[model samples]
Target: MTRHQTSNNRAVLRTAAVPARKTLGGGGAAFLAALLLLSCSNPSGPKRNEAKIQGVVYRNDTRTPVPGATIVLERPVSVATAGEGGSYSMAFTADTTYITNVIATMPGFRSDTEQVVVVPQKTSTVDLYLRADTSSPVTPSQSGDAANIYLVDFTPEFISVSGTGANDVAKLTFQVRDAHGTPVDSAHGVTVAFSITNGPSRGEYIFPSSAPTDPRTGKVTVSLNAGTKSGVVQILATAQVGTKMIGSEPVRMTIFGGLPDQAHFSIAPQMYNFPGLDWLNRTDQIMVLVGDKYSNPVQPRTAVYFETAGGVVDASGYTDAAGLAGVTLRSGNPIGNDPVYGPGFAYLKARTVGENGATVKDSILILFSGFPTEMTLSPSSFNLPVGDQAGEVFTYRIADRFGHPMAEGAAVNVTSDGAPVVLSGDVNLEFPDTQSSSWTTFHFKVNRKESDPGAKSGNVAINIKVTGQNGNRSISLTGYVAY
Candidate 1:
C-alpha cells in the first residue's frame, strides 16, 4: 500500500512497511538491476528530498505546555495547531535549507516568534514561549521580583495657561508591584524621585519633590506646576529600594504660553435672508480669543486684526483683559463683488501675536442663512426595468451656503426634462421637511414613460428649483433605466 502527500508543491509517496527478501541467485540479481533502471529512467518518480518541523509551545511563567496554541510558518505560509501535549509538526520540501519564520499565538498571551532552519530528510525542533499580557487584571504574588510599575493619574494632560503663578497644576500617582502583580510594601520607606525628562522648560514638582512610598501601601502622590515657557512637559519617576532602582512609567503634559498659538471665535444670529433684494442688511457680534500653547489666555491689550472673505467687519481691535477681542461683522449689499449674502458663507478671521512673538490666528464660518446653494442626488445613476410601475428611488440632499443642511420646511420645486422621465406627481420637488442636523433627504422616483415607443436603455434628467426666504437656486441631475 502507498499513501500520497503533497508538500511545497511536490508529491511524496509514503510506502507501507514491507518484508525483506533473502539473498538471491543470478536470476534474482538480474531482476533487481532491471527494477533499478526502470526507477532511474522514470522522470515522474517520487523524490525523498523533504524535511519536517516540530515544535512545542509553553507558558513563560509556568514551564507547562500551552495546548491549542496556533503556530504559523512564514515561508509558504502554513499553520498547525498544538495538540494535547503542546506539540506541533509541519512537513515541507527541503530542496534547499528552509530558513523560515515561525510564530506561536494563544489567547490572553503575547505571541512568540522564532526563526528556524530545516535540512533535507531531517526534522528540526523549534520551541516558543508565550508570556501573559500584563495589561489584564491578574493577581500578583505576595513576594516576588518587581514585575511592573505604572502611573495612576497624569491629569490636565494639557495646560493652555502659561506661568507657574497661574496655578496650572496636574496630579501624579505612582504604584509599585511585584512579579505576581501584588503591591510591594517596604518596611523602610522607598525613596521615589521625580524629574522632567523633556520640555520647553523643566517644570517644578509642587512639594515633596522626593517622597517615600507609604509603608503600608505601595503608592505615592504628587503635584506638578507648569514652567515659564510654552512647550511639552514630560516627567519621570524612579524608586530607590535598597541597592536596586525601579523606574516608574513616564507621563507627558502640554503647556500653552500667553502668546497665542491658536484662537477661537463665535458669532451671534448666524442666519439671515434677503427679502426682495440681492443684499441682506444685518449685523452680528463676533468675539475672538487668543490662547497660548498651553491654552492659557494671552496677556491683556494684545492687538488683533479682523479680516473678511465674503463680508466686512471692524478691521482692528485689542484683546480685553480676558484675552478676548470683540468686533461687529456686517453684511453690506448682495452685489456681485459683495462679501456676504443669504446663500453663501461669510468668513471672519482674527489674527494676533503671542507673548513669545509667535503669530496666532483663528477664524469662524457663518452661513448666510437662506436657500441652499447646492443639491446632491445620491446614486446619481440608477437602474430601472422598462415598463415597471415601481421606479427607482434616489435621495436628494440639500445644503446651505456653508454646506450645512437647510432648516426644516425649506421650500423647493422639482421638474423634469425629456419624455422618458417625469416627476411622479407633476411636481416631485419639495422641502425634505426633515429636522436633520447635517443635511435633509427627500426620496424621488423616476419611471419610464409608457407612451414612449423607443423604450430601450436611456437616461432621464431632473431639474430642481429651490426658493428660500432670501432667493432662488437651481440644480439638475440624471437617472438611467433599461428596457
Candidate 2:
C-alpha cells in the first residue's frame, strides 16, 4: 500500500510492503507471495534563501521608543510598522549580500534613514532616531517646556556713546528652543525677555525688552541704545515656559569713544627736533591724543585742527579709533632765528571741540637745527715748551650762522701736521637744554714728544674740520713746538 500526505505547505511520501494471497495462482492453496509498493508525491521545489532587517525607532533627544512608526525599505520596496515595543522587521529574498536604505517616519516627527547590509540567511539590526519637526508646532516635553534661550545674532557689538553717530544703536536677536533643540514659537506659549545683567550704571537701554517668539522662527529681536557713559554691557535673554525660566549665556557689548575733555587733550611729536632748517623736504610726525573726562579714548573721526608758528604743518586731521590724530610737519619757510643754535623753532598747536563745546587746545615746540657756519680757535698761535711732556691747551668755538651753537651731535675732528698732539674732551656737541650756550667748544692739548726727533722743535700746523647736515667746514692754525 502507498500513501501521500500534504501539511503545512509541505508534501510527504509514504511506501508500504505487504504479503499477497494470490501471487502464484496455480499454487492457490499452498503458497503466500510478497509485494512491494512505491509512492511518489508531486515536487514542492527548494526552500527560498532570505535576509531580514530589524530595529527599534526612538526619539532623537530622549531616546524613548516611538510606536506606530512606519519603517520603509528601498530597492524592492517593502514596508513595516513598528510594534508596541517600537520594533520593526522586514524580510527580503537574497542570494548574496546587498545594501538597502531603511527609513523610519512618524507624524509630528522628522524622518530618519539608515543604510543596512542584508546577508543571505542572516538578520541585520539597525536603529533609527527621529527628531521633532520644528516646521509645525509640537507639544512641549514633560521634563521642561523650554530647554534653552540662545542669542542668535547681536550686531554692532561695539557702539559709541550717546549722540555719537549711526553706530550708537545695536541690534540683538534671540531664539527659544526645546530639549530636542527645536525652536519653540508662540504656539508653545514661549516668550523672551531681555535685561542688562552687568554694565555701567544706566549705561545702556533696550527697546521692546520683552516680546513673544515668532511663530515661524521662534526669534525675538530688540534694539540697544547706548548712554553717555562708556563701559562693557552684558545683556541676558530669558524665556518663560510655564513656571520655568530659561536663560541664555551672557552677551557682551562695548560702549566706547566718548566726547573729548580739556584735561585729557594733549599733543606730542615723534621727535622733539629734526633737521627742519637748512635741510629742505624734512618732515616729522605730530600726534595728538584726546580722551574723555573718564579717561576713555574720544570718539573716532573727531576733527582736529593744526597750526604752526614756523615751518609748514598739515591743515587738519581726523582722530582714529584710539582717539589719536597725526599730522605731518614739514620743514619750509618762516624759519625761527633764535640765538642759541639758530636752529629754527616750529610752535605747533592742535585744537578740537571739547565736551562742553569749548575749544580744547595743546601746543608743542620742535626745533629745526641749522648748519654750522662759523669756527674760531682761541689764541690763533701757541707754543709747546721744551720738555719730554710739554703740552699746550687750545680752545675751538663753533657756531651756526646766527651765532647759535651747532646742533647737538655735530662731529669735529682735529689733526696736527708738524706736532704730536693728544686731544681729549667731548668731540661731539652736547645736547642743548633750558640753559644752553651760543657756541659749542672743544679743547686739545699740544705736546712736544721726546720719542720723535721731528716733534722736538719745529713749526706745527693744526687742522680742524666740522661736519653737519647743512655743510662741512675745515680750518688750519699755525703753532710751534720749542725745545
Candidate 3:
C-alpha cells in the first residue's frame, strides 16, 4: 500500500509539471535541468549567481492585458520597474541582496510583485493575481480606498518620470488628467512637495523645484539629497487648474542617511494634571510639568502658558531651570466645593530662544479624564401681590454661577430669625423657559401666619438648595414682601 501511494504521488507531480515543459531542441535536457536549478535555488545560499527574470503581465484572473504598467524593480541595492503590457524583467546584480521588486499594478486592481527568484531558465512565467474593480460611479479616491483600484495605463497615460539624480533633481512627466482620469489639454498649475526624513528635519516639506502647466506633456522636477536616510519617504505632487486641487499622486523613495540630524520636543509625564494624583481643592498644591527632549528644567523665560476651554482652572506656572517647576493655582469660589473637572482638553505652549534669538515653539495638549464637581447656590428674590391668600401665588427661581434666574425647580428652604413667618404647602415648579443650564424655580402660597396685609412690609431671605451630576448649588434672594 505504501509503495502504491508513493507511485500515485509521483504521477500527480509529473502532471503538475506540464507547464514547466521545455521547448524541443538539442539543449532541451540541459535547459530544463538548469531552469529547475534557477527557480529552486535561494540567492542567500553559498551557490548564488546572477539571474534574469522576465514575465508577461496580465490582469488578474481575467486574460485582459494591462498595457504600459510600470514595472519597478528595486532592492537594498539595484532598482527597476516595468514598462507597457504590465510586464517587467530585470537583472539582480550579483552583489545585491534580498528580492528585487517585479511589481505589476493598475489603477483599479491591487499590485502584484515578483521578488528575487533564483532561476536557471532564460525566462520565467509568473502569473499575477489581481482583484478586479466591481464598483460603479465612484471617484478615484473612493475607488482606491475600497478594494477596487481602477486599472490605469501600464505606462503613465499622460506623462512619464523625467529628469535625473534623486539627490539634486528628478523630473516627472505626465499628460494632464481631469477629476476623471481622462487626458486633458493640460493642468493650469502643478506643484510637487519634497521632504527628507532622518536628516536635518524629519518630514520637512518644501515647494516644487519646477512648475508645470497645461500642455500635452508636462514635466516637474524634484530635488533630493544624497545623504537622506535610506528608508521609505513620501513625495506628493499636486496639479491645480486654478484654485482646486485636480489630481495628486505620491511617490516613495529610499536614500542614504547623511545630512543634518533632526530633533523634536516631548511632553513631560505625557499627562498634565492641575491637582495631579491628588484632590483638587484649596488645600492641595496645583502644578504643571513642562518636559522636552532634554528633560532638563526649562527657564522662566521659556514663555509657557496654559489655557482651558472650561475656564475652571487657571494655568499660571513656569518651569524652573531643571525642567521641573510647579505653580499653585488658587481656587476660592464655588468651584472649590464642587468642581467641574472637564468637558474638554487644555492647551499648554512653551516658547524659547535658540541661537540668534530664533523662536522655538513647543505645544502640548492634555485630555480631561476626570469628572467635574459643580456646587451651586440659588433663590433670587420673589414677591406676592396684596391679598394673596394661601391659594394665591408667589414665584421664585434658582440662580447659576451668575446671579441670574437660571431655570425652574420645586422646593425652597425659607428661614427668618425674627419673624414667625409662614408659607403655603403644595409648591409647584415651572419651566416655561430655561435661561441657564441648571435652575430651580417654584411658586407657593404663604399661609395666614401674619394676616395683617395693612401692616408694614417685612424682609426675609429665600434660598433653594439643589444637587445634580456636577455638585451642590444654592440660590438665595433677599427682598421685602408685603404682609
Candidate 4:
C-alpha cells in the first residue's frame, strides 16, 4: 500500500506493497491482485488533518485594509501574502493543538504580531493592525524632533475666571503623527509634554504635564483649571522622539467675567449743578464706574440702572471696556429740593448686580437750577455828570425762587437807549459757593463821554436784560446826564 501526506504545503510519500505469497493458491493470488487494483482505482482517499489561520490586515489609524501585506507564521516558519482586500489564509497539517505567532507587515508600516492557536482539523481566525512609521532614525548627537506633533482639539475655549460648573475647566487633546499624517503612538517611541507658554500669573494650571502617547489612537488628553485672575491663556504641546523634540503651534483660551465690588463702585456727574429746572433742552451727563474685587475692570456689557428723585434719567445703560456707563438727565418739572443744599438739588442713584447676586448701589447729589425769580439793582438809576470820563460803578444781584443763585452761565447785557455808554463788567454769572450768599452779583462801570449823544440829550435810559435757563428778564432805568 502506498500512502501520501501533505503538511505546510510540502508532500511526503510512504509505500507499503506486499509481495504475492507462493504458498497461496492461484485464486488467492488473483483475489489479492484484484484487491490491489481496486485499492489503486478507488477515487476515495484517507482524510487529511489540517488547520488554517485567516483574517484581514488593517491600518491602525484609519482601520482601512492594507493590501499586499506579508503574513508570517513563526512556529513552522510558513509565509503567506495578503490579497487585494488585505485578506490572507494559511493552512497546515497538524497532529495536535499548538500555539504560534502571526506577524503582518507592509512597506512604510510598522509590523504587527498576534499570538494564535491552531487545533487539528480546526480553523482559527486572527486579525492584525499596523501603524505607519512617521519618524526617521536619529543620531545621539541630534536634537529631538517635534515636527509630527499637533494640538488637535480643545474644549471650552472661553471660560469664566474661577467660575463654577462648565466654565471652570478646559480639555485639550494632542496627537503625534508621521510625515504622511498617520497617527503614531507610544509603540513608536513617541511621548508628549504640555506647558503654559503665555497666561496670567498663577491664573491657570494643567494636569499630567507629561505623558506617553496612546498606543491605539496616538493621542493624549489633559485638563486645564482656571484661577482667580482673568486673561488670555496659551498652551503648547511638544513631542519627544528619541533625541529630537518637535513642538506644535500654541493654543489660546480666554478667561473672562469679573463681578463688580462695592469698594470700586462709584457715581459721578459731569457737573454738580446744571440748568435743568424748567428748560426741557438742558441736559446733564451722569456716569458710573465699576471694578472687580481684584481691582480689574468688570466685563464689558455689564448692566447699570439709573434713578433720580427729580427730572428724567435714562433707565438703563451698559458698561464699556473701561467699566464705565453713562446716562443723560434731562431737565423736567417736579424739581427736587434739599433742605441743606436748597432748591435744584436731587438724589441720583446707580445700581448693579454684584458677584454674590446682591445689588450694589452708589448715590450722588445733582443740583438743577432754573431762571432767577428775583433781581435787585442798586439805586435803580445811574446819575453821571457831563464829561465824566471816570466811570461810576453800579451793582446788580439775582437769585432763584429758593434764594439760591441761578445756574452758572447766565448772561447779562446792559445798554443805553439815547447813546452807547461804555460799560465794563462780566457778562456771565458763576454759581455761588456755600460760604457765599445765595445771591449772584454783577458789577458794571458806566462812563459819560464829552462826545456822547446821551450827554447832549440830558436824559438817558439805561436798559438791562438777563437771560436764564427757562426765562428772560428786562429792566429799564432813567438816567440824567447833567450839562
Tens digit per residue, CA lDDT, model 2, 268-342: 887564555777667888999988776777877889999987688899999887889999998878786545334
For candidate 3, the 10 contiguous residues with the lowest summed lDDT are: 140-149
RMSD vs true structure, all candidates: 24.5, 21.4, 19.4, 22.6
- Candidate 4, which ten residues in sequence have the lowest lDDT sum? 136-145
lDDT (CA) per prediction: 0.59, 0.68, 0.37, 0.68
lDDT for each residue of candidate 1 in 1-483, tens digit (9 for 90 to 100): 232222343333322212232112355346445645654564542654767877677755433466777776665455688887678998866566645566676666666766666567877677766665464223222334444567866665554443523336778777666654445555434667888887776444455577876554467777877666556667788876557887876777665545555533323323322121234555666777665555555545567888775556788877665567777767664321234433455556777765456556766655544446556766666666755788766667666544455543456667766546645542444444332344445667677766667755766677876665545667787667666
* Model 3 TM-score, 2 decimals: 0.23
Tens-digit lDDT track of model 4 for 367-404: 77666777777777767775667767778777666555
Off by over 4 Å in 1: 1-147, 160-167, 202-206, 258-289, 292-483
Give lDDT for model 1.
Answer: 0.59
C-alpha displacement of 230 in model 1, angstroms?
A: 2.4
Error of 3 at 372 (Å): 14
Please identify which of the two predictions, 1 or 4, would achieve the higher lDDT against the true structure: 4
Task: Give the range of the ten consecutive residues with the poorest summed lDDT in model 1.
Answer: 15-24
- In model 3, which regions exceed 4 Å deviation? 1-54, 57-463, 468-470, 473-483
